[model samples]
Target chain A: MLNIVQRFMKRLVRQFFKKKKKVKIGLYGPPNGGKTTLANRICEDWLGEEMGSVSAIEHETREIKIKEEISVKSGKKELKFNLVDTPGIATKIDYEDFVKKGMSEKKAKQRAKEATKGVIDAIKWLDEMDVVIVVLDGTKDPYSQVNITIVGNLAARDIPVLIVCNKMDLKKAKKKKIEAAFPQYDVVPISAKTGKNIDKFYEALFVIAG
Target chain B: MSLTLQFVPYGEIENLDSTAKVNKLIKIVKEEKIILLEGRIEKNEETLLIKKTMEEIGPKFKGIELFVMYPKDEESDPIQRLKKSVVDMLLGNRQGLTIIGPATIVKEIRKDPDKIQLLTKNLSKRKKTPASRSKSTKKKTKTKKRK
Candidate 1:
């Protein structure tokens, strides 16, 4: 009789919490894929502030940053959610790579250590995401193992995904390649740095988050 | 400078659970051997393997390059596809090939409808040029020729 009562109470509490929770939108991709830049763009546009720092170096965002209660207006419709900017996921992180990029050996090792933890945290947080925006560097090949793994995880969880092909400002940015790589998801080509075609991304969010 | 390719039959890992199967593959990959697995693991297991790989990243062990190729159902007729599905249900879905290798060696794995390509990096040549000496050498040669 006690166990049955406990189960009933647990179900009621879960239902109440689920109704009160905000939709969590996650920014995920490989390192240096402009995830932070996009996060900053969204925060700046909606919340009137930046979310995190952006850098040219890989693994710069070594922690998960969340901006809550962002309300976006599209015409007469409005959507509200919490934005999550996760660390760039990578299968490999060698301190030697950082050393070659002009960091001291000690700092390189420290960055590498933090980066591995960041990847693990990003994967663990996947279960909490309501919608995920997969940011890919448009100048690079989209047919990579890291990209595959991220997409595969999202598919397994049945989460809605929007692929953002960032860096469309660059001459080498190939949006077509990204489209071909992930034909299932809606691909939005935008330059988060230059703020090009970002409006289209905002409009697409309504359909995806619906 | 030597490369090793270890072929793992489905029977070898048929009894192991997802974690053990991933661990076995990682152990072989950490030794710098390329694994050609007879069957592809589950999608969730692939994600688990990636999570484990991220945890194991360190100085000597960089990570892994993985790719799986399976036969497409679109090529078959509806009846043939149904038959294939029934067979798969009974015998397990072992109609795919999975390739996993250390990232230090295997650079990329490209796949098409009909074939797959595995690209490798030359570590010895890379070690010889601590920095990207090859690019600097090319620039020097170009300047000399111009002079």
Candidate 2:
């Protein structure tokens, strides 16, 4: 009787899991482009929990933060999405800021070099992701080095990419030039800070995920 | 003794006082004849020089600790293996890094000044003068002409 009960329990757990499709997405952009803000928003909305820290400091996230095994309800079936958040990709650092802020020159230089490695390592994550949600800071110029490099690398690989033009809540956001600069991309302008247009963003992702 | 020369990336040179200070405190390795020579580069192109040094020595040195002193990036984990290597190299008691005598190291570093300069400029640490790449390309032309 105990053996039958154990077998029944095993079957129950297996049945509960059911059939689910995993959608692996890599979220990337230049450092400070609000990649984490978006990732946190997604997890919080879908999973009702804060997954990571959202900071304003440049390269605040020095490591590739992964929020995996996220369960989202898609119609009648259950879906799983693995989201990987990576460091920003700013190739240049304003050394003057480091000095004025009382940051040691050595530490600043070391940090700048670090930002580069973090970016490169993050980009490498693209090869493993099913889709790459490349974040963009609309407040900054669209023709920045990190943006160009990220888009260029994505195009070369032919990976499915979606440009998340975040920070729309800021008055200085310029969406047109960003679209003009990269005419060939599917760009979605959303404010990760204010949660504007997030539902639409999720809807687009669901279609793509399907 | 083997000589070891350090060419820190230009982006990294701004903290010369810190990098150099930290570097000086490290114990020098003597087994692989390690001599650590260092210079603060201001040009980005000089990075190519540093990467070249790693590529050249990386093969013979087997593991990076044997020769690379500042090869690890700052973003690496404080407890990871690579960071430990950097600390080991900086502290001068190279667990795996071989120390060449300074005299021997200087000779090795000076052997290819022109080649080194070319690779250094490729690093883009210095100002991107339009002529940087052309300058090296000119040398290639001369070599081709001689051939």
* Best prediction by DockQ: 1
lDDT of 2 by residue, B1-147 (tens): 112354323334344454353333232321223333343222221222222222222111211121222232345565787666667556432221222222212222211212221111122343334666689889999999999
**Fnat per model, in the order shown:** 0.78, 0.00
CAPRI-wise, candidate 1 is medium
Q: What local lDDT score does residue B86 receive in model 1, on the 0 to 100 scale?
A: 82
For model 2, the superposed segments whose C-alpha errors exceed 4 Å read A1-22, A74-78, A93-96, A102-110, B1-147
- Distance from true position, residue A97, model 1, in Å? 1.1
lDDT of 2 by residue, A108-147 (tens): 6565555546655665576666678988889887764346
Q: Give per-residue lDDT, candidate 1, residue B8.
A: 96
Off by over 4 Å in 1: A1-18, B76-84, B87-92, B112-115, B125-147
Q: Return the TM-score for candidate 1, rounded to 2 decimals.
A: 0.85
Query: Can you tell me the CAPRI class of model 2?
Result: incorrect
How close is chain B to the truth by TM-score, in each candidate? 0.81, 0.19
Instruction: After the best TM-score superposition of candidate 1, give how far the Cα of residue B133 lies from its true spot, in angstroms.
Output: 23
